[model samples]
Target: MSVTRHKVWDPLVRIFHWSLVIAFAANALFTDPESNLHEWIGYVVVALIAIRILWGVVGTRYARFTSFPPSASGALGQLSDIATGRKRAHLGHTPLGAMMIYNLLLTMLAIGVSGYMMTTNAYWGVDWVEELHEIFVTWAEISIVLHIGAVIWESLRTGVNLPRAMVSGVKTVPEGIKIEP
Candidate 1:
């Protein structure tokens, strides 16, 4: 069967997505925590998240928050589909994926805020603030791992190239795949 391709992620969204990946990885894995580079990368992450939030409000169809609003029922439905071995390709983010997006956004924001606070006189040398930042970073790391696994699982299940879609802004759905509207 033939494949039908549709543009889903926009250019800004794709850029933000990959930029966050690099920024987060650099700070979490490579950068020296006490150095200026780490602080700058943290700020970059904050800026990227801010841009993404704005784009979610005023960007293209797939980038808008309205396109994939957080819903308990929607998440449950997706879980059910998985349990029942049903394949459904979502035009934008699946409900579970939407939840992950919110999770990462909030988690990243928390990390950024805490990291900034550590640099302030009021919060500097505060053990709790530093610990809180570490906690958020750990959570974000766990969430990132889950996010990657879910993307791979969903891509194979629905026969969609999810990573490629994010990079190219288009998803090529197989003809017989059930696509969520």
Candidate 2:
């Protein structure tokens, strides 16, 4: 057996991941069409997305987008593995998981931007913009569902507690796997 030590994730990435989840959920639960709370929550999401994007560029090794955002082919390969029940333990996010991170960021950004447009006088009460905002929200929700489902599936397949890995920032890969530092 061989062992390798790796920096799974940086503090900023871990904190942003969980905070974004909580903020998105809270925004959905607390925001109402008639209340300013919804708009405030949208602003918070915008801020979070902005910070995360910036960090993705300049963050630590494990936090940078280049570190894990896989190519389209890589994602397809991972999907094939999962479908065929040949999954392996990955120290960091799998190819599909990496793609989902991108998806979540883009979706959240779309929701925030569309929501912001609704607040502008030029766009406020504009039927199409409002409709677009609703569409983006729907897309974001769908992505969230898929993300959660993937996490659960990965946990079952790998026997590694993904949620705990995110919390503790360390994953104990089985013998013979090499981790990148």
Candidate 3:
């Protein structure tokens, strides 16, 4: 039986994801302690993050948060599957993956908001806000590393390259799975 391919993530979402990845990675590595480049990168990240949140609510079917939010129970259920190595192939994000998506978004938002606050007069030179901003960035980095690792592992396990799927917006489903366009 031939597996059918369906459009999952939209082009805009894919572009946003990759672009944010590049920008965030660059911001993390290339920004100097006293340079303005980091601030500019933070601004771009903030805009991208805000746009993505809006898109989550009004984006394409597979891209919408409603389509794949993993409830607490759902996430726990996947833990068993992961333990048993009996993971089900999903046309979109799996339960754990969905949670990671939410985490990444929220963490990025926190980092961006805190970083922005440090530039404002009310918060400028406030040592505590700077410390909090640094903490947020650290979490964002850790979350991103975990997210990439999961993507790689899932791709290898399922024989489906997730990055490729995001780029193409088309994913090949298993023969027994039915994707409704």
Candidate 4:
């Protein structure tokens, strides 16, 4: 069997993806919540997300939002594909993956906002603001776990090197696999 390689993730997208991983891990696991480093990492995450949002508008073919918009029906179809063991390679993001991207983006923004509120005079020392920040962090953690698992599962099912694709900006898809445009 022959495999063909295609450029999927652009340079900016790849950088943003890995940079977010590092920043999120640093803030979530390694830094104290009250430390300056944690706050700085949070700011970095906000900036990264902002850049990604802009990239999704004017970036490469695979990086654009038009390449993979969130859709319930499309997600359902991907779910159905998984249930039946159907193999397909998505050049951009699969439907479920697209949904997850949007989810993490929004969740990170919420975390940033809540964390900022905790630093403000009006919301400082407020119990609910702190609680909301914690909640968003926890949700992001759970979502990260699920995201990793899904990537591995889909990679195995479709025989696509998803993690490598993110690193190398290319996906080596097996010939005859149906690739989503």
Per-prediction TM-score to the true structure, in the order listed: 0.99, 0.89, 0.91, 0.98
Error of 4 at 156 (Å): 0.4
Q: Per-residue lDDT for 1-181 in model 2, tens only?
A: 4433344767777888888888888877766765788788778888988998898899876677877876798788778877887757666678888888888888888888888888889898899988988888788899889989999988888666678778878776655433332
Report, for all candidates in order, the number of backbone clashes.
Answer: 0, 0, 0, 0
Candidate 1 similarity to native, TM-score: 0.99
**Pairs of colliding residues, candidate 1:** none
Instruction: Order candidates by TM-score, high to low.
Output: 1, 4, 3, 2
Off by over 4 Å in 4: none
The per-model lDDT (C-alpha) reads 0.96, 0.78, 0.82, 0.94
- Candidate 2 yields a Cα-based lDDT of 0.78
Q: How do the residues 83-138 of candidate 3 rate in per-residue lDDT, one tens digit apiece?
A: 87764667778888899988888888888888888889999999999899889889
TM-score of 2: 0.89
Lowest summed lDDT across 10 adjacent residues in model 2 is found at 172-181
Candidate 4 lDDT for residue 169: 95
Please give the RMSD of candidate 3 to the true structure: 2.2
| Candidate 1, RMSD to the unseen true structure | 0.6
Model 3 CA deviation exceeding 4 Å by range? 174-181
Which window of ten consecutive residues has the lowest lDDT sum in model 3? 172-181
